[model samples]
Target: NSGYQQQPRQQAPQQFNNQNRIQSMNQFDLIPMSYAELFPALIEKYLVQTRASPPVLAKLPW
Candidate 1:
């Protein structure tokens, strides 16, 4: 029980830092886009990636 509670406390800051790092690394990256803004572009990108690469995205733990 104590370990479970500690997990989130540790992960929350790490995830926030990762997001900040990504945004800082690329000012024009898609982290801030809404669904409507992403619809057309995201589909094209997703389709291209699936065709160009193996389906590694499906193997994510999440």
Candidate 2:
């Protein structure tokens, strides 16, 4: 039996370039930060402000 030939992949015209991607990112004024650096600060800023009334006793595995 003969196998079907694979088709060539096409790159979309709206593909992102570095400057465009960076420009899009800049719209958020976001700079990449290490998870180690951002996580603690984020947790501190958000978790400290959070009040969990009748806090969760346990989470389901699912």
Candidate 3:
């Protein structure tokens, strides 16, 4: 009835060190300003050099 015995204990699985895992973020440059800031400057520069055409009216939705 007691023929089987507990097996000898073994060390737990080895964990990977930080050095082993590849770096997630390797950014080499900083983020520039968003389109909102850049677009206005571009539009202003274009308007100064180019003339605007007549505007077309459109129906408004309620």
Sort by TM-score, top down from the best = 2, 3, 1
Model 3 agreement with the true structure over 2-61: per-residue lDDT tens digits: 233333344555556867833243334422554455457778888535468877669655
Error of 2 at 30 (Å): 5.6
What tens-digit string does per-residue lDDT give for candidate 1 at 15-37?
34634652222123334445555
Clashing pairs in 1: none
TM-score (C-alpha, index-matched) for candidate 3? 0.24
In model 3, pairs of residues that clash are none
Worst 10 residues of 2 by lDDT: 22-31
lDDT accuracy of residue 56 in candidate 3: 66
Error of 2 at 26 (Å): 11
For each of the candidates, give the backbone clash count: 0, 0, 0
Best by TM-score: 2
Clashing pairs in 2: none
Q: Rate the local accuracy (lDDT) of all candidates.
A: 0.43, 0.52, 0.52
RMSD of 1: 14.9
